[model samples]
Target: MKTITFNQKETSPIALEFDELIPDEIFTWEKSDFDSYMVPIGNSKFPLSNYFDVEVEGTAESPAEVVMIINGDLGRVKYIGAKMSNGQIVANSSVDLHCGAEMSGGSLLVNGDAESYAGREMTGGELTIKGNVKEFCGASYIGDWRGMTGGIITIEGNAGKQLGECLTGGEIRVKGNCDILAGIHMTKGLIQIDGDVTRWPGGQMQNGDIVINGKLSRSLEGFDYQEVITDPTISGKSFSGKYIKYLGDIARNGKGNLWLNAEKNRYLL
Candidate 1:
């Protein structure tokens, strides 16, 4: 596989956008090509050569044949690899907003954390974050109803608010805690949270499933609770514990189900 590396020379507290540096692009680019590249920073684009030295080795016949590696603290760099259709990208540090937005194929791995919109509107591929992620990790853009058309996002650490807001397809697995309004307004998809949740999940959801394996802080009044079911079948998979099913988001006339582990959440009883 072809490799491209980005090593930061200076930290920009203002944040730089690296959406143009994905493997789907720059696969055929040479060292001088990247040197002549201008990356978006704030409202303007500056020479990427000024921030990080460039190195390109091997060759890629297509976008799917390339791999990009970015190393350093990218907390101030946004859109690391947005709208990529193929190939692979690996970031050694935390990245900023839109890290993998609209990705259609290949894989993106972030060794550390990521900012919001990590996999927004993604049609395919896999996005893995080793650490925690912030709000709107896999959500739709503001005023849009379709979020994450396809793909898979695995978060090893905690997640912020609206973990998969307005989700339409795809799957999101969170291994740690989550904040408020997870899967809000989701029309279709699957969201599995293995840790604690703050409140108001699956709010106004029309369709889709949210499986909570941990304690829930509160339940919405709009949801009507059903009987406790043991080892219930959800999304073609069977869970080992008791679960409470709530159908709601009635304000939108939704019939979606919110499955919360009964044994883990005694406070709602």
Candidate 2:
């Protein structure tokens, strides 16, 4: 793979948007090209070279052959891999909003935390976050009905509210705790929460499956307890536990499968 590295020189006063510097667009560019490239700030444009030292190694004929490494604190950078169709991006520190939004192909790895809207409306590919993510991760964009039509998002840490809201396809796995309204209004896909959930998952969801392997603080009235099964198979994955299955977001007259660990949610029994 052709490797390109961006080492942060200094933190910017305002958040910098990285929608333009992704491998799909910059894989063939040399250092000189980056030096002259204008990156969008809040409202104005500034030379990309102002914040990072660019280093390019080898060459690539296509974006898929490129690997972008961003090393340093990018807490003030947004949209690190937005809309990329192919290639790989590794952000080594916590990133700002929209880190991997609308990506159709490619892989994005955030070694640290990510802000809201990560993987919003993504159609395909894989996104892995090693740390926690804020609200709306894998959710739909504002005013958009479809969220994350395809792709897989694996978060090694917690996730905030509305995760996978309005989702139509794909999968989301949160290894840590999750906030409320997960899989809200979702029509398709799968969501697996390995830790605790605050409340109200699968709210108004019309279709899809949600497997909660940990404690659920509360359950919504929209669901109807279906039955209990031992070692239930959910979304083609075998789960080793006594699980309570529920069907509905009946408030919307919808049918979605919600599985909760029976031992952790005995109150629902």
Candidate 3:
């Protein structure tokens, strides 16, 4: 296996892009290669060594055998693991926007908070955020119709608005509170939220499922309340306790499912 470590030497006012530094592209790179590499910042490129002290060890013939670790504050680094197909990446500090955009495979763990667009359009792999995510956690890029086609995203902290906007596939789980429009326009996927939601979780969704374990502050008029179910199994994941099931977004002729905890949402009854 190969291990590459990047210790931040300095911070830049403009965000440094790390999309090219993923294990899929650098698994065979030596320490010398990193020393001479240039990283993109805004419209210009600067020497990567100017911002980070890099260390490379071991060897890898494939991306799956590589591990990348970034230490220190990376709040100015964008696309930290974008488009990687394999390997593992761990960020010890908060990250900037587009942390794992378009990733097809591999795993990325953010030990701190992340900015918006954390996992936009990812088709495979896993993304775990230990802290809050601003917005659009697993959605598509702006103006794009297709969103995450596969993969999983688990947010330990709260999530901002439009959490799974335009989602086409895959799954997202939020352990903390979530903001409005969690699965708006989603076609196929599963979103499970263990904490309270602000409102309008499955608005305009054509097909998909959203399971909320916490109280919902508001319900959209487009959804029609259905019967309550006990210990439901949704998208291969089972949950205990009674849940209220509703189907709609009928405003758009949608047929999505939204399940809310009956115990927490007595106001809906």
Give me the overall lDDT of model 1.
Answer: 0.88
- Candidate 3 lDDT over 1-269, as tens digits, reads 99999999999999999999999999999988999898999999999999999998899999999999999889999998899999999999999999989989999999999999999999999999999999998998988988888999999999999999999999999999999999999999999999999998998998899999999999789988889999998888889999999998898888899999999998877
lDDT of 2 by residue, 131-228 (tens): 99999999998898889999999999999999999989999999999999999999999999999999999999999999999999987899998999
Error of 2 at 165 (Å): 0.6
Ranking by TM-score: 3, 2, 1
TM-score of 1: 0.95
Provide the global lDDT of candidate 3 against the true structure.
0.94
Where is model 3 more than 4 Å wrong at Cα? Answer: none
Candidate 2 — number of clashing residue pairs? 0
How displaced is residue 124 in candidate 1, in Å?
1.4
Candidate 2 — worst ten consecutive residues by lDDT sum? 232-241
lDDT of each: 0.88, 0.94, 0.94
Error of 1 at 162 (Å): 1.5
